[model samples]
Target: MSDGWILGLDLGTSGLRGVITDETGEIHAEAAAPLTDQSPTTWSAALSGVLLELKPHLSRVHHIIADATSSTVMLWDNGVSSPVLMYDDGRATQEYAAIRDQLPADSAAHGATSTLSKVLWLRNHCPVSSGTRIAHQVDWLNAQFLGFPPPTDWNNALKLGYDPIREQWPDVIEQLLSPLSPPKVVPSGTPLGSVQEAVQDTWGFPHQCTVHAGTTDSIAGFLAAGAQALGDAVSSLGTTLALKIVSERPIFSPSHGIYSHRLGRRWLAGGASNVGGGSLLEMFSLEQVRALSKRQPGPKRGIACYPLRGVGERFPEADAKKAGLWPDKHLPEAVRFQAIVEALVAIEKKGYERLHALGAPAPQRIFCVGGGCRNAMWQRLRSAQLPHVVAQTVERPPAWGVTRLLADEGP
Candidate 1:
């Protein structure tokens, strides 16, 4: 195995993050650049800037892997289409319904903004030429390094209707969208090819550096958090709450917004809840939240705040028309803030319960990530609700996770 450094790049919704690390996991260099927009040209420029920032370390890098926000897709001919559909874009309602009617009820493609739905919408509304291709953000970004028509990993392909268990595109999907061709799917860390000569010449990357297949950003985060055991889990307390538990068997419950991503012999199963730090931010500023964190959480106030950003809920309950529930308007600011924190913890507890009930191994320990994980009071609140599962904070950037892929280390 090559002992040179591995380059892991994460193309997130807002920016690009790159890290250069050795096989022993020592960080050599790291850099990040903000993305002003989601357009293909913008992505290209931002990525080029980030790579240039890492140009000093390129000579030592042997392999490269990447991860991107789930379901962020674009149409590719000689180049990417204008105005690529973002992961959360919900303009494919009709296509979503058509997909739901054909796939199993438990399939993750039920969501209106799923990659598969986007593809269908593109076929009808966008109307690409026969030679045009469908590619996710990770695929397109990585293609700049390896080549165009990039091969995608299973995790990124899940919402696109690729059956990871069968390791092939289902006939139903092929027949349903016969006009479009899907990219080749491969295991997350499988080598695709070498870095293109142009990239090597421009960035000073090693001529022999290989480009490996990549996964979605969430999975990349899970891997970076170092949850390798079957029952290990990671909870991301970002703008929204997301959970991923490592399991020996896959779990699929679309009704509850639960699904699994293949992780070699094991699986990563969990869901995202609409309730999280975003809810707290809506009612209080970051300073206020930090101030409230200093206040000890009193006994269960029975606030029952079903914190949703808008008129919908995904995990623990999949009610599209569900409204945000909050404590009585008369409650004090401190009290209400504590209640919201507790309510999010309640949602996390229920999410784990649902996963356990679905045959996933009970999470022995849960690693916390994202901005909300910094709140000591909230961590204590979560531990109180999930006493059986240990809660601890972990700093695992998605770029680090993809670096592990290049190292061929199991998550």
Candidate 2:
């Protein structure tokens, strides 16, 4: 195995994390810095701080890659003045409607929060000069090391309407985004160029060290799970329960919030549901949930519940007007908590079932990640609900996945 180390950085919603891993994927060192805000200044500061923390090991590093939250966008002329429009920003409703009218029904850009919609919105509301460049969060972050104009990966450009399969911007999108230039697109893990001279001089990186194209944070997390077979899957139990499975055929059902990201010869198909740790947080403190989860109750039929943080539902059954359901307030707290856990597992099973019906292979095994994975009781409950499928937790964060990409590309 090569002795050189690889650096992976993940720019998440809450913070920036960097991991230094050897050729075999064993982490040598890791560091993180929390972001106080979403502005380019804060992001750049956090990134620099994290890299400084990893500075001691820079000389051994051969490659660097980064993943950022998908759909977060910024406009740049000489430098950034405005805060990035985060992935969840909903100010592009009119742009979304216009995109829906222009693109196919199954296009990922049909949603209001998509990068395409945000680009259209920025064009009219946050106008930039003709010489300006538009870039996704990952693109901008990677450019900090590799220099501009920024280069983007296919996975990060999906919501921006770059057709990965065709490896080109579609005529419809080109017409809609007239005058503004799209960043050069390449596959995730493709090398952009060597780290800039200024970065190398400051960080002590080797002259040969290079920066590779990166994916979205979600896709990087999926890669970290180490799932390679057709039926392998990864389930994220964060604010929402998100699922993605490896498949030979891509699936797209915008109505159900299901989409696919290309993974080499295969596809990663899945969707997110409005049910997860957010439901448990509603009634119990972190300490209370930890204590309550340990006191397993005897087998009892769970109360019917749809544990959403608020109104509306996506995946399994997509209904914008769907209301969140809950057990009677009079029920014991332990009972209510267990019932909610079971209900979320049921929703997970329904999500997998939906995927199966839509042509994706049934999940042969699942690797779990996110904050909820810490709850052993929830893991047990999930395993019991999907008895035939093997379930386990992957402790590595998304930064490690980008390290894997670097290792795959070699020194």
Candidate 3:
């Protein structure tokens, strides 16, 4: 039987999942729905499907917790909000060019995928009303449950230019969108409001159920990883390889492809490298890559290959125009394989170095999370490349950490 159950929904970039867990982190029931970079109607429909699957056990669930993929922006207007753009939508190149012109010469352009660029793109393309307010994905989701406009949580607001350290949206946001509505800002874990009475009734949840302000999935995953203090970093390897290091102070590195985020009690500073395993897979079929790994000792090869397939360059290199797959000349499969592995390891190492150089505490140990942790060869390569540091993988995914958080009580 379920006891002190909580519902944690992960609104991931690939899909949506709901896990019902007890106070001790035991998952009792779960449901998931497939999704993609679709419109608001699509996301709503998918979420509804997943919730309906959890209907039979609804009575056991106490709190509803959720966090969507970060930086996805939506338009809030006429009570019928719609998803205008996704974080990866590159249609905003022109908008990005415009923003760079406004930014300080020292302030490198915000990544093309940032929420600010998305907002600018929509404003330029769609005829949104001047009264419209734009919000991150999860913020809009919270608004749906509250039956009113909802504010963005601090962490998710970072990419939108909300000053988390100061707890205020930047004035530039107003200046950029002259008649645009300003979004209210809230702290992570703060309850936006109680779930709408009608939704409560339909879902068989308590009428007094609170709707906690959700964050990005990555932020929730990091929190769930049991990273007790600062100087800890979490790396996720999926469609993209991303590293996030928690810092006591804000660390901005537009040059390093770095973006700053506020998570739990500290700020998350790191960058996403364009060259992840996925991009490598494109050049070498999965079967071929696995076969090659059997003959290669990875870091032992000493070949240099700076990953970067399509997305420009970030960190260490810091050149947005830097071309990917460097060195016009070529090398053998074994060397290329080693270079590829080292390239990613280099990103990990350089990231740590950059963070330390910025005055952040050094990480004594890095807790590895995500699919990359499962790759035995990748682990060996990382160990060889980072001999000074220890990397350990958790059997379960960091996403499961979200379930653990919902089931526990904390301040």
Error of 1 at 147 (Å): 2.8
Per-prediction CA RMSD (Å): 1.5, 2.1, 3.1
lDDT of 1 by residue, 1-411 (tens): 456889999999889999999887788899998999888788888888888899999999998889999999877787747358898999999887776788866667778889988888878877578788888898887788876667889999898888877788877888777688877898988888998998899999988898888888998898788777879988898999999999988888888989999987899998998888999988889999988887778878687788787999889778899999887769899889988898888889889989999898887888888988778789888877784544544586889987776554565
Q: By TM-score, who's the top model here?
A: 1
What's the best-to-worst order under lDDT? Answer: 1, 2, 3
TM-score of 2: 0.95
TM-score of 3: 0.89
1-411: candidate 2 lDDT, tens digit per residue: 254788999999999999999888889999999998888889889988998999999999988889999999977777754458999897999888766888967777777788988888888776678777888888888888887756788888888888766778888888888777777788778878998999999999999998888888988898787776789888898888999999988898877879898876678898888778989998789899999878765576758888877888778777878998887779888888888888988999889988999999988888888887878778888878774445555578899986766554431
Pairs of residues clashing in candidate 2: none
Clashing pairs in 3: 256-315
Tens digits of per-residue lDDT for model 3, 293-367? 666373365555676777566665468677766432356665666667667778787777877797666875677
Model 2: CA > 4 A from native:
1-3, 387-392, 409-411
Candidate 1, residue 180: the lDDT equals 84
CA RMSD (A), model 1? 1.5
User: Which sections of candidate 1 miss by over 4 Å?
Assistant: 388-392
